[model samples]
Target: MTTTRPIQSGRRYRRIIYALIGVGIASLLGGMFLDYSLAGLVVYAVTAVGALALTLFLQFGSEIELQDEREREIGRRASDVTFQLFGYLGLVVFVAMFLLEATSQYTMTARAETLLYAYAVICLTWGGIYVVFRYRS
Candidate 1:
């Protein structure tokens, strides 16, 4: 009798991501403790770009499919959950900022406004797409 083992591509990809995360964290700490802030930022930027490229490659460039049906479904569901969670989190932050500004006479920072605007745009885009798809279907 012959037996076959399942493909471990997903496991391999996950391991790579974890390793990159570890290295990124180590680089960040080393940069901070060594008083090389610029080096740390450079390291982080490089790591971010590398990670994005690696993820795109793993997700779309692989010759073999790594995710099974169940894995894909789970990923979809997890994405939805995070999307909703982050939307709510952004709203909460916006509201908190308003309250703080009103009570403490604090002005919103440019960074905070930029973040809020980005969050709002993303949420609106998501909502618009969802509505269009739901109505069309």
Candidate 2:
């Protein structure tokens, strides 16, 4: 008799979904604060759809419908590549900005710095999660 293994990494998918939902919410809020009512509504709608999808997946998804080993492997590889690319891009942007600031009289704006900080935080969090799982396993 042969037994099949269930997709055990459902939690990972859940985390990703939740993260996306969080981003959508943040975008919505930022739009509202900036008086972009239409954009905010659009963001809210998209976030609602994402939440609905998460709910449906949690309630009705089967093991095979979740993610198999091969799918998980592909996701990991994609994530690693994306993270590396983002890191390189961020480093280039940072160095360019640093040189520009040093050589010119212009300074970084508060809004730009805030966005950069947020991106840095997101990257750090994503990388930290990857490291935790890679070493834990």
Candidate 3:
């Protein structure tokens, strides 16, 4: 590869960062798949944030481990892709929630908390990724 690739990470920290990403994704998936309850969704969102924090800490901890130009571009493109995805996902959920409320005969109340938290996760994820990408860029 070009000089753009970052130095290969040591196994320990590399494993830690990889695990953090996996756990973060798992948390998000679990939140969506679990019962349609506010509390469970909140707990899962918290877990995702914790995983995100850990990833940031390990990734930038090494001065010499900084990503090069190609890596920076990769990170940016990745975040932009993720942001578009979550943005659409959140908007669809919100629209569906409102539409269901408007026309449904059942007096079903939408869980505002769940909707808010879902959007919050999208916001935070996009923001976090944007920051990392921008900094590296």
TM-score of each: 0.64, 0.54, 0.45
Writing each residue's lDDT as its tens digit, candidate 3 over 1-137 gives 55533455534445665676666566556656775456555655665677567656756664445455787899989978997887888788767766776788334445775666778886887689879999998
Lowest summed lDDT over 10 consecutive residues: which window, candidate 3? 4-13
Candidate 1 — which pairs collide? Answer: none
Task: Using TM-score, give the best candidate's number.
Answer: 1
Q: Which residue pairs clash within candidate 3?
A: none
Clashing pairs in 2: none
Give the residue spans of candidate 3 off by over 4 A: 1-6, 9-16, 19-62, 105-112, 124-137
Number of residue pairs clashing in candidate 2, backbone atoms closer than 3 angstroms, sequence gap of 3 or more or interchain: 0
Query: By summed lDDT, which 10 consecutive residues of candidate 2 come out lowest?
Result: 3-12
Q: Write the per-residue lDDT of candidate 1 for residues 1-137, one digit (tens) a residue.
A: 96433347666776676677677778888999999877887887777677777878877887545577888899999999999898888889899899999998679999999998999899889989999999999
lDDT of 3: 0.66
Candidates 1 and 3: which is better by lDDT? 1
- lDDT of model number 1: 0.81
